[model samples]
Target: MKQTYGYQQKARQFFAVLLPIFITQLSLMATGFFNTIMAGHISQQDLAGVAVGVNLFLPFFGSVLGIISGLTPTISQLYGGGRQDKIGFIVKQGFYWAMALAFLFIAVGWLAVPRVLPLLNLEPKVHYITAHYLLAVSFGIVPIFLAGVLRNFIDAHGHTRLTMCITMTSVPVNIALNYVFMYGLFGVPAFGGIGAGIGSAIAFSLNLLLNVWVVTHIEPFKSYRIFHHFPRPQFSEWKKQLGVGIPIGSTMFCEQSIFGAVGLFMTVYGTVVVAAHQAAMNFTTIVYMVPLAVSMTLTILVGYEVGAKRFADAEQYIRLSRVLTMVFVGVLALLLTQFKTEIAALYTSSREVQPILTGFLVYAVFMQVSDSINAPLQGALRGYKDVHVTFLLAVLSFWVIGLPGGWMLANWTAVGPYGYWIGLVAGVLVGAVCLQIRMGQVQRKFSGQEG
Candidate 1:
């Protein structure tokens, strides 16, 4: 009875963390969903342009988010260890790091967008939209990164509902802004596809504002006094975060960039194919938020336990998270397979795009299953601060093994665009196996030390 009660309590705690995180993640992905849907309505070319541009942008943006994510485990561990006073300083340093990265990405966008888009030989309008869209979104990079630092701090403190409310508030605002700029409402002129980027920038800025307000006004958060004083960049502090963060950022880059690379490859098959690929990918990404949230919750819960020297508790959370994640993703994969045609229709009415989109969703089902294992395990490892190995595995799986295999099958075999999707499935499965093995080793090592 005692053990059963303990497990029940743990499960409830897990869902308490998972629920808000899932909603926050779902809300965040909704912005992208609307972006893709609205862009598709304009024209297939517009859809392709935005798709390519997003693919190009995500690797950089995801890296920023991943690097800042270091703060979540770091802060959670601090909180668990009864060292709450230290969080403000770490967050302040994170801001400096985020600012630097934001500017660096902006510079890269300016110098690289023109040179890179032309190489793809995209349609002139598509190229124009893609270039201008990237430029417009560049405006919000700083705010987005800054907000990320704050959100992580808040989430690590177990105030996930606060972040969820903030994000949910931003979605409607983002949709309104997306509509205003994309179709041109009231006094605003239609920016077409470029408007999506503009809306995102404004929305991202709003997110930052909301995060700032929460951290400043909220009770426990307000007590942290993160903004009490801004400090100069501390190299020692930066190095400490970088030790954990760089690998995290790199791992995210590898995973996100693989999709971008796949999207870019789809362009060769023409606009319709590219758009369909994006739609399928977009839906799968929405479903992806579940495991991602589970993974993130694992990071927080496990980090808290590890910091408190509760190794047994951390292992239990790990096991519990994996079981729940696999079951949830399994159900999602079924729904995706069952309603693929309907889901595909959500992106576009064109019969040409619909069939292709459904086909891609089939491959996505497999990827989601693989992610169920790897994603949360990766999160558990992050809790252990065991990031370097995962980074190497990501590279070996996605870039070294996945990309090359996809390219060969794509070009040489009859698989065509489907070949790339297959490669994605293979890569994720490889990463999943390796990550499971790595997590096992870490769990035993920690548990043994505790014993």
Candidate 2:
């Protein structure tokens, strides 16, 4: 009876954290979803331009986001260890990292996009719009990074609901702005795909401002005075964070870049293929928010337990997290598989795009399962600060194995786009298997140390 009660209690706690974060993540993803859908309405070429533009930014943004997320485990550990007072200083350092990354992305966007876009051999119209879209969105890089830092800091203290409120609020704001800017509502000039980028920049700015307000003005966090005294960057602390964050960031860069490469590959097939790929990818990304949320919560929960020196409890949290993730993703996968055609149609009315979208989604269903397993396992590994091996495995699976196989199959085989997706599935499966194995090793190591 006691064990059952404990299980129920743990499940409840997990959901309490997971649900808000889930909503928050969904809201964040909605920015891209709205962009794709709105751009789809403008024209297929516009949709393709937006898709490529977003993919171009994704690898960099995802890497920096992962780097900032290192703060989650750090703050959670501090909270668990009763060292909450030090969180202010750590958070300040994170802001410094955020600023540095923001500038780096801006520089890359300016220098790289010009050189890289033409190399894709995209249609001239599509290429022009993509460049404009990226230019507009680059302005938001700082706000986006800063928002991530604040969200991670707050979430680590178990205040996920605040972040949720902030993000959820942004959805309506983003959607409204997207409609206004994209369609030229209320006498504004229509910017089409570029308008989506503008909307996102405005939305991210609002999100960062709100996060700053809440953290500085709210009761629980205000006492920490995180912004009261800005400390100079401590190289040692920065190095420590970079040690953990760089691997996490690189892992994400590998994973996101693989998909970005796939997008670039699809462009060679034509605009319709790229738009169809966007539809399929956008839908799958929405579904992914669920598992991603649960995985993030696991990081915090496990980090807290590890910091408290409760290795057994931390292991238990991992088990509970995996079970919850499986149940949720299983049901989601089943629904997506069963109704994929109908769902694909929702993204675009273009007949050419719908069939291709549906086809890609069939593969996406299996990818979802592999993704579900891999995401939480990676998060659990992050909690243990066991990141380096996972990074190596990710490179081997996604780059060394996955990308090469995908390129060959895509270029040389009859399977074409499906071949690329098959490569994605293969990569994710390997990553899932390898990550789980590493997690086991980490658990045993911790167990031995505790013993």
Candidate 3:
């Protein structure tokens, strides 16, 4: 009875933190879902264009988010240690890091968009629309980075409900703006696929504003005085964050860029393939949010336990997170496998795209289990500040092993796109195994056991 009660209490605590972060992440992801679905309505070319543009941008933007995510564990540790006074300093440093990354990405977008677009050899129409979309969305890069930093700070403190509310508010705003900008409603010029970019920029700007308001006015945040006095860049702190963050950022870049590379590679096969890939990727991404959220929650919970010097509790949280993630993903994979056709239809009305989408989901179902395992383990690793090994493994698994295998299988074999997906599965499985081993090493180290 005592053990059962303890497990129940832990489950409750886990969900209490997980649910809000999950909902917030879902709302954030909804922006992409809205963009993709609405773009699909315009034309298949538009859909492909939006898909390519978003994928191309993800490596840059996602890396920034991952880099700033280093702040979360740091903040959680400080919060857990009852060192609230130090939290403000860390957040101030995060802002500097965010702005630097934001500008760096914008510059990369300027140079790379022109050079990289031609390399893909995309369809002329798709290429033109994708370029415009990229240009427009580039405006939002700073706001997006700023929002990520704020969200990380809020989440680390376990004040996730406010972030959820702020992000959820953006969903409707984005959807409405997407409809207006995409269709040229309210006498606005129809930007077509580019409208999705415009809508996202506007929505992200609003998201930043709302987050700032909350952090400044909220009771929980007032004591931190994050905005009170701006501090100069502390080289020591910056070095510490970068040490932890760059590896994380690089790992994120590896994962997203490979997926983005897959999207680009599909363009060679033509629009139908690209559209099909987008539908499958978008749907799977939504499903992925479940494990992603659980992973983030694990980082916070474990970081708190570790900071408080409760190594056993941290280990327990990691175990519970892995079990919960696997179970949830297993159920989700089964459902997606069973209902893939019906689900594919939700993304587009085109008969051609639906069948291809359903086919892609077949691969997606198997990939989810590997993804579920890898994501939570990565999060648990983050809580331990064990980032470099994950980064090294990510490069080995995704770039060194996965990308080459995917390219060879996709271009050289009869399997076509299925081959690319198979490579992804293999890479994720390898990464999951590697990350789990690393996590176990950390656990042993913390327990003062020799490996």
Candidate 4:
């Protein structure tokens, strides 16, 4: 019983750490909102094109980020476990891995883009717009990779708020650039949909620049001389990071691959449903940041606790995290339910889009619980380095339960798009159950074995 308060103290400390991290996550969500609003201002076709462009590459981009993100937990563990010397070593490996990924994707993504887009069978106008948008957007990949190293390193050092501040600074700048580039404001060429991609590239570059600046000037990194400390990565330590990170990265790939599959599935459904689904998903993304941020914080907190050999403390932190995350998501679902039309209206001016989007809003409300439940357990499992189980489970639930079910309900039955979303509901429920079980078992193994 007394141990509970100890856990509470640890959780509160973790919460303090999370404030900036959550804000950083929220900044990312805000970027999506900004993109959605600006895209809507252009035209429905433009809006839909951008959505398709995003979905097409989302899995690959997610896999890259996941590969880099594996470092944050591993580095935190290195610190908490008192392997102070290995911190710089692991961070350098993360950067190298990110850099390598950046180069490989540039050649691969450019070639893949043409093949992937037409395969989706988009409307001509949307396809044309997406091709251009993707071109400009692709230029920012390496910069984003660089930013990941600095961002994750800072977060692992227990100073996440700095990244949030940099991201916050970038948001308005991105919006302004979108305005200038999209409409030829202030003597800039009006590239329209293509300009949106350029606008994004500009924003990403600034974010990378700012992250580097903070690393040099900020108290935490500056004091530590984080750059010099990592002049080179130790082979032994680098291998350890790859060992821990690769599986988690693949786990992320499994889930994102499913979304890519869904995007392909959406193609046969025609343009209107695809556009409406994009809008609804965009709005839902805003809600999703709530749990995503919370769960991400839980991962770091649990990782830190486990590292410090406070096994039970890690357990309590996740429980507290789940409770807090649920409260936020539940309230958000209620607000969206009450204001569905107003919410949908924010996406498109057309009456056609607004009505169909409302259906997606309804679905979003129900999906929040499952979404909230999934991230932390995934985080927890990653913390314990329990990769293979997480990977297999994600594949089974999303593909077998979600994708096939969505197909049967949508195509095989009369429900149409509802069938697909109903599949989403079932898949997430299964995901939540699987993740919960996995988290328990993971915690047990880590608690008993080493700590």
Query: Candidate 2 local accuracy as lDDT?
Result: 0.84
TM-score of 4: 0.87
lDDT of each: 0.87, 0.84, 0.84, 0.76
The deviation in Å at residue 147 for candidate 2 is 2.0
The 10-residue segment of model 3 with minimum total lDDT is 1-10
**Best-matching candidate per TM-score:** 1
Q: Rank the candidates by TM-score, best first.
A: 1, 2, 3, 4
By how many angstroms RMSD does model 2 differ from the true structure?
Answer: 3.3
- How many residue pairs clash in each candidate at the backbone level? 0, 0, 0, 0
| Residue clash pairs of candidate 1 | none
Task: Provide the lDDT at 378 for model 4.
Answer: 79
- For model 2, give the 10-residue run with minimal summed lDDT: 1-10
Which residue runs of candidate 2 sit more than 4 Å off their true CA positions? 1-5, 42-48, 121-126, 185-188, 266-278, 336-359, 407-416, 448-451
Candidate 2 per-residue lDDT over residues 365-442, each given as its tens digit: 888888888989888888877789979988988888788888889889998978888888888899899888888788
lDDT of 1 by residue, 1-451 (tens): 0111366888988888889999988887787778888999999988888877887887788887898898888988887777877888999999998898889889988998889888888999999999999999999999999999999998887778888999999989999899899999999999988999999999999999999999999888899888888888998998998788889999998888788778778889999999899888877787788889998998888888777777888888888987898788778878886898898888899999999989998988898888988899999999888999999999988997788888888999998999888888888899899998998898778875551
Give candidate 3's total backbone clashes.
0
Please name the candidate that would achieve the greatest lDDT relative to the true structure.
Answer: 1
